[model samples]
Target: MRVRRLKWAEEFLGSAEVVVQSPQDIKGNWNTYMNRECIHLEIGSGKGDYWIKMSDMYPDIGWIGMERNESVAAYAVKKSEEAKENRKFIQNEAMHLLDYFDKEIDAIHLNFSDPWPKKRTTKRRLSHGNFTSIYKQILKDDGELHMKTDNSALFEYSVVNILKEGFSIEELCVDFRRETHDEDAISEYEQKFMNKGNPIYRAVFKKVKEEN
Candidate 1:
């Protein structure tokens, strides 16, 4: 269902507008949110649950949650307004990633991105090298891509893709739930799957050097 135009939300976001329309606009005057040169991104943020918590936890850094769906995006916007000073939610797709971020992003988060199980639809996966390449273009030299998922097949494919794409896989775990995950902020789907004892897979890929 579509959400009504929230006047409060519009005012809240307009007051703390950090979103950019193109990569070209990312540079210059970035100290609007935090004095430090750092930014974090969460792709496919479903309900802004994790985003709200993270923004509350980390005040010195900026958080941007991107969700293409309008209703879902509104949900994030509502949460962001509650902590309007540090977090922002964008209603858009991940394909336009470069448009919103600059080269100073400290980290990128891909929490349970679409599996895209079929071989033919592999390119659509966020973990695909093509997306990774785009991510590298806007990420800082030593930035990290933190990813988590419960899909085993997709996890395996991501590992292969990251390696083939020439990125260094610093940390990887087949079952994130087996061990106590401290930074685990439960997402809308994560809570539902936790009851089933689903094993969540995770990996942190760091861009070591430019790919030729």
Candidate 2:
């Protein structure tokens, strides 16, 4: 996802009010920051369509969007310049997620993540075991993970890895867009995929609390 550098992108990243400059410092106080009782996080939030729209749809919960790319993150913030106080952006990668959150997140969203469709790059997939292990540590007991993708291979890989990593599937949909899903917002990539007749796959995995 090489983006042609935008001149204003860097400037916005430096001063965007919605961008959390030091997310780690607010690690355990996310709810306090958003003034919401529940919190949701979206990793690999490319271009911010889902992030911004989801926040608007669910105004009662705290919504945080994380993206490693500075320019892309800036664009997301720039697009939602008047983003509500319930939303925030972390300009960082998934690997560093634990530093910014505790085991208090209510839900996590993975929307059209990079498939990293190569044997050598398997570790880079957001649903990989390594990332799931981090997710397990940071997600509260019973917290749910919601993932949607147009790639069948990636969808299968995520299901296998998530189940292996101590999660149980609560729901699965092969052609998620076939029926009306007014509760969820369609991403820019998703709209394009739907227009091309691609089937969307969605899964909801819940953290299985360790038995005492």
Candidate 3:
């Protein structure tokens, strides 16, 4: 179920032509809809800098940006009004990801996600065991989960929790910005954080289905 680019991208993605009104209907068909072999989903795509830039940098790969905050989602949409090809926006929470995508996602990107530092709000973190359970279901067997954040505590928590969920840690870097990763884009917010001597932690967790 591909969304037709009707008018120029509007901020309210629900009514915008660039967003899928009913993403649930597009489950398992996102790659087909976007006409790309691989699809990457960016959860909590605040302000859309990473989503917009990544889509531009990788036109051959389908990109789906998900942001629950409609206001923030709008900002990202407006900024990338013309970069609609191989891209679609979703204005919904990540919990409903199962309703919108099956085990079809090639990769998932979690960038500068909320730390949810409070001990009681641990489950609210995007990389919590609960969320990783969902990620396992939506991701392909060989899919990878790429996460980056400026919060050290959150990074440690995520690393522990993700491993507890049984995902394999394929790559882990304490200071992601220290290296020149041309394949990965650094958002303005991230660059500014690095300028402040803040180190960005990044990890790549991979999944491999067990052979029967």
Which candidate comes out best when scored by TM-score?
2
Error of 1 at 50 (Å): 1.7
lDDT of every predicted structure (CA atoms): 0.74, 0.92, 0.86
Candidate 1 lDDT, 90-143, residue by residue in tens? 667788877656676778888888788998999989888778887887778888
lDDT of 1 at 34: 45
> Local error of candidate 1 at 113, Å?
0.9
Local accuracy of candidate 3 as per-residue lDDT tens digits, 178-208 = 8799899998778878899998999999975
Identify the candidate with maximal lDDT: 2
Clashes in model 1: which pairs? none
TM-score of each: 0.83, 0.97, 0.92
Best-first order by lDDT: 2, 3, 1
In model 3, which range of ten residues has the least summed lDDT? 1-10
Compared with the true structure, what per-residue lDDT tens digits does model 2 show for residues 139-165?
988899999999999999999999999
